[model samples]
Target: MTEHRCPVMIVTSMPYRLAVIFLAGLMALLAGTLVARDAHAQPPHADPAWTDIVVGAGDDGRRLSLTEGHRLVIQLPANPSAGYLWQIEQLDTAIVARQWSSEPDYVGPGDEITGGATQQVLRFVALGEGQTTLQLALRREWESEAPPVGVFTLNLQTVGPFTGANYQYTVPPLTQPPALSPDDIYAEGLPTHFSWCEQGKCTPIRDQGMCGSCWAFATTGVMEAVIKIQDGVERDLSEQYLVSCNTHNWGCSGGYWAHDYHQNRVPPNEPDAGAVFEVEFPYQAKDVPCGAPHTHHEKISSWSHVGGYGLPSVAAIKQAIYAYGPVSVGVCASDAFGSYKGGIFTTDESSKCTGANHAVVLVGWDDGQGIWYLRNSWGTRWGEGGTMRIGYGVSRVGWNASYVVYGQTPYMPIGGATQPRVRLFLPAIARGGGGVAPDAAPVPTPTPVPTPTPTPQPVQQVPSNGGFEDGRVIWSESSQKGWPLIMNTGSLVIAPHQGSWASWLGGDHNEVAALTQSVQVPSASPYLTYWYWINSADSCGKDVARVLVNGTQVDTYDLCAARNTGGWQSRGVNLGAYVGQTVPLQISVTPRGPVDLATVRRFAELAFEVVGLDYRDYVVQDARFVRPADVDLLVGDPRKAKEVLGWEATTSFEDLVRIMVEAELSNPENA
Candidate 1:
């Protein structure tokens, strides 16, 4: 294992006094604290008779049967150095148990080294015979308010015990391809090359990973580049928004870009649909349900194919790029294309490169060299920094080319004037089997034997009117502006999760609604389950729903950028620790205005500029942490800072960012 050293905190170029103050601010904001662990690092229940089953990425949604006392090991691909970690997000503890004692096995060379690819391993022991689900999220700990970058869910069924030898498995270490110089391709006596991408202007190349969502990436790529060209603004649109929310086409499994954008509009309300910001719905590289976060979208006026279904001429494609910025094109991505590192890519084998299936973007072309510049969804490590130069017409480079026309006007917000209503439909709860009638009149008397009332068992007691069926009879309800907490049949779209009524948390801006109930925690089954659905036009951080027990926050839901739950979805909370004690359970929601994506983009750009780094580095790429929402952020006043530190910001935000980057690069450790 390599020694893990923290990045040296170095502040240079600026005056010593200002540098000291800046360094202090950086230390306060960039501590990079690790996340807390709920589970132990040691194996909880070690037994010689126990068996083990190992699983890894792509094993999500698997249904596995495990005997009691057996353990299931999940090993997910992770890069801790990249500031992302995989942790258990959800688990049915009644069915499976985890402890903190078991240490995970590090399967890569640079175990704690920066920028190392590592594996996150978690072990769960089957508790008893029951069905449960296990969910894990890959994310940066500091970005707790943001959605996970990746998710894995598994369904587990524990069966009768049967002792077997613990399975032993080996995970292969991750490796990178040999570095190939782009100079090798430039030296090949190629013709003059022309590109539309200006330094720090073009949209950054993105990675599609193991998913087949290249079509969505291609569409967003062209749209983003065109927006930069036409509006002089850099926007990072959500490709995952189309991959998950666009129902007209399949997500991840594969679909055409035209079908995703042109055919599918934002649903449940919004019609002027296009692409949303990447922060709203981060890509999971899987088939996720259409969540509510996608409702806030950027509307495009129109899009059209450059040429018909047939292959387009190189000149036509070039003209489209010159007019609209970049043209989305389809091509056959064969093994040769996949293995491409450098040099002009061309293949003569038709059988290998069959139909124009995979989608990519054509950014520029050189007629003299008979080559076209294409941007791909693979990571920067692939090809030449996620770009390819190919002979015109090679690999079906110009097939099904298309471009997006700029929107004539700014799009109105989705969900109209007021925030989208939190509509729910809960079925009526039915109480069955009053009691089993005693051996129906054994004597055959004219009067039938009355059903015997069975003695009630000491099972966990649910809170009275827990489902809101009694309309707040046993709960305390309060809200701003006298809005009712319990919503009863106000509209056709409004209903309950399981009854005719449900708790409506928030609607409209500047509203704080809350519902609370006092209940003695059940000892037998201490888990409390409830259903909730959120519909909001608010942005994250500004608007949130918090769950509390005994006045302490237990869970919190950021309303903005949250998955709408489609309908009411069940969530569980274990009150086992407070068993037999009466506690106040509350759900409070506060809705506010959304954080503008445009504003966020501008902030990121300015901040990068302050540090003297390229704004493109912050604008188009994924962040290791979620930024503070507009409402939650406090801009520092240079005057106040000057009074305290005897100095004020003297340069542009870009210069500050550049200075930080330069200082880090100048460090001897980096060398």
Candidate 2:
């Protein structure tokens, strides 16, 4: 190699050359590291189709569909991230059918997108004939830093003419009515003579705790009376036999009225080989022969004594049934009674439970308010624990002066050779208590005082905000615990940077301790204001918030219901027709389901705003900002704001970035 002489500059500045070489090497190393890091850290997948969507239908069984004339509903799951937007379009021709570029205006079947999972009912007529397709798309709202996650395409097809044959079935009348007792007669008023069971005259059927075997007990009680009347012998019928062996029908839990009759009339009595009656079986009746002695006699005798001393109206029948034993009666099988609660009531509200869809015994009635009490076999936990009341003399039971009655004994007796003997069992006496005869003493008469009746109070209407006056506080910190201060308004700026707040859970523990304040509304007003916040993390983790106005719980909004990741929203409720004069607004947040401790770190936010005017005004104003043209632009920049609201982003970009970082760090997955 030729002798290489160092350049004069290199020789003079050896240190500078070394420094340059070191700097270049370091830069190259850094660049390589950065490149490798970038290679590994792929950009997050922003799929607008990954949205959690829920489709629901009303009681009418009509769901949201793209077909014209048919209503369709689309609901977003949980709270949505800010800057979230969506569009509904016809898939066939790529035509933009309907677009929601802003926050949801209405929370019904189709008017909402960004806010929680709301039932949006959209009625559409059939789009031509044949099959037509539709699509739904979602993305991060403009200016939202979080990349859009749940974008989805829904394929909907419309076909054929509307078919109206989807109808519920009905129970036809029985071919032949069951054998009824001749002595049983439906009367309008109390008979002149009445002979009811004395303290030890009749037996009582224990409800068996929560078990809904009232029909069995009532049936057995009737049989016992028949035995006494026909043979001068009182026998304890096996109620447990019907309860345990009636598998084809309801068991210890519940059954229909006809079930008890059918089971008893069936041949080869199938008694549980394992059950024990509380008492020894009495003499057998002439109609049915005794098979095996009942395992035990669970019947009481003094119960009828208490129930027999009541008046002869529907109220008296219900009271007797409730106080002592099950009273057999007729009822209309109307649909409204399907969810009947246990109590004495009388109303014209009838639906499906009419014409004997079911049969039950009226165990009690309320004379003070004319309510008939019936014992159901749907278990004690059902309908006041096996007892419910229908309106007395309201024709709810299909009894217009005359109805069928099949029970142990008749309420009124015609001429007979021998009067029926009724036996009753008293639990109080068995439990070491004194036994009081039903007719031991005359009932004390009430001494009525002559006084002027006070005038009735007029009902007042409640305002929407639950406050009667402007700027009035409906809820305050001192008056409530675990309640959030809600501000209801038409225009509100909700962003992640405001903080990770939840409508239900706010603090680190995700438990609302106490609210700082409460708002009060006039008692005369029927409506009340409510507000709350929900965080994306909390919603994603399954926390829920509920709103209540004047003690009436409106609805429960889960993270899926409120649909606010880190933003604010408002709604108006109608409460202007309550009888109360004053109302209180309440807000509460509870976990929707199980939550992991780690997820609590990514808390959600909740806030409330009350509006005094009708929701239509506020809703209309909010709807004005929703434009299909402005959906794709990023939020915040001068150009975007001008296009949407004719204003610049008041919330700074740096603040928005900081919020994103905090949210990400606090996320349970990240944590």
Candidate 3:
């Protein structure tokens, strides 16, 4: 306004002033936007103090402490399609603020079923330093007057500001037993029958569910029993911590006791290096990513093979069980083995012996009955209240016998508290008045047993075409008029994960395709296992894949979220609950929006072409990048290459792109 300059100068200055004002406004807008975003954002994923509480993993009635600004994630099973949805019944907003809740994008085999059982994931943040209670109810909205089918409650305490501190509780050490001479150690004689379980020294039987994590259960069971016997205190160590946190062991897919016990650490016997408590890390029965800054509550001083490799002698196993509380051993766990309800289980030629496929604990022995008492992980409904009697040499009952001596130091939470223990009562045994015969010559324990068994019922097999290799012989399909989306054996475009055939369910928009088969579930440990691949062109919630049992949705896959499977993923569903019933198993795919078969095909071809592979081969057999890492910003600079390596590209940009596409297609990873 004060400018009184030449006409040309005045015009130039006006434009300059306008530019400055425009830049200032933009700066102010950006600053305000950033402040608002920061205000509403939740804690970053990198936050070390975030806690994830998995419901049904024994998280109920537990009190948890968190510092202000920390996050808590609660996962609960839900079936919204069946009119059962989870809702917050009560929450103290003054102390804790609800962020948001949504359904998970992917359902794994552990939770997969036909009954539409999915997970509802909720997140909350501590707002102020105070105490509060979080409660949720699962019920139908229309039936508000009725009681909820399930309820979940958690006690939460929000401490002051975040202070990165190790909150630890020191376990009062027990009085060490006096060392004895060799003669004194051998003074005691073995008994005719010995059972830590009968003496109330054993932990409750745990159900591994559909997971093949018997090794972890067996390991933790022995640890719990030993802790009780040595310290005169019962402890429920976490099988999940061993399953998930141990890098040397495969979670839920079977593992070796030697590897988990000895090789889990770098140098062996690392301080505070052992399994956490069950309440701190509950059993999920599936692979979960190991969390950061994990704390161990117990450790083992030593573990060794009882009889030095192969099948140990029955006497050595008995001695180990007597001296070491409980011992872990590998078993065959055949279909017949699961069906052994009572009496000594013995194997015949029809049993089809393979090798040790499952792990269990040899809790005791009854020499009079010529049987060994084995504790199982198949829940209280199986065998004799989650235990069974096997003849000394049956089903490789004592192969790979190993015992662990617990470390004297046990850890507790910062509050100097231990989680409450849940005890399981075993069913009473009906014994005859006559006792067993005296100890006989020690014999080698049984060798390995047959595998792929189910719960205790007669083997009611899955559909003959469960793998989808016989075309559609035993399977039925339904789809839209033009899209025939079902299992394929003829298409070279999408190869099967295994044999010569597999199911291909989605291609067109606004289309629904499903495959169905009837399967008879066994009475015990019945489960269905299959492999699947997801190649989706659409994002999450736009296209969906689902598994239904008897017309009820049990599992669902969000196309976009599951796209990262990269290749065939094995999934299983437990059918033990549906014993003796033949139910329909259905896999269905529904695509929404304006997409067509041609578009889907084109997208797939383009994606696979870059790797020089057919879509099926790239997905099923040739996954180049197992998991691609993310970078916030990545840019290609030809100048850097020229300056650093003194190299210049001769190929044209267009031709380079074409060559890259061909190279990627022919790559072995995409073969």
TM-scores for all candidates?
0.34, 0.25, 0.33
Worst 10 residues of 3 by lDDT: 20-29
lDDT tens digits by residue: candidate 1, 1-671: 32121111111001111100000000000010001111111223444454678898878899998886567888887643233567668887766765322243334422111122446566777656678889888865444577898999999998855332232111111111111122211221111244767434478889776566777888888778767766778988887877776756556545665433633455554444666788878888777876764445554567778777656665566556655567788775433465567655644212222345467888887542336888987768677887887765565666678777765322112123333222111111123633212222122213223223233223224566554555646556555536455544442133332334544455534445555555567565554444344443334445556555554444455554332322222234444446676665656654322221123334444555555654442233212122211111112223434567777345544455567667867899998
Candidate 2 stretches with Cα past 4 Å from truth are 1-68, 71-240, 243-266, 269-325, 330-344, 347-349, 364-367, 393-395, 398-671
Error of 2 at 13 (Å): 99
List the global CA lDDT of all models.
0.51, 0.30, 0.50
What's the true lDDT of residue 118 in model 1? 48
Report the Cα RMSD per candidate. 31.3, 30.2, 31.7
For model 3 the TM-score comes to: 0.33
Choose 2 or 3, whichever is better by lDDT.
3
Tell me the tens digit of each residue's lDDT in model 3 across 455-474.
22222255544544445555
RMSD of 3: 31.7
Per-residue CA lDDT of candidate 2, range 213-287, in tens?
A: 434554565445433443455565555555544444445333433223332333245343322332543322111
Candidate 2: 10-residue stretch with minimal lDDT: 20-29
Indicate whether candidate 1 or candidate 2 has the larger lDDT.
Answer: 1
Ranked by lDDT, top first:
1, 3, 2
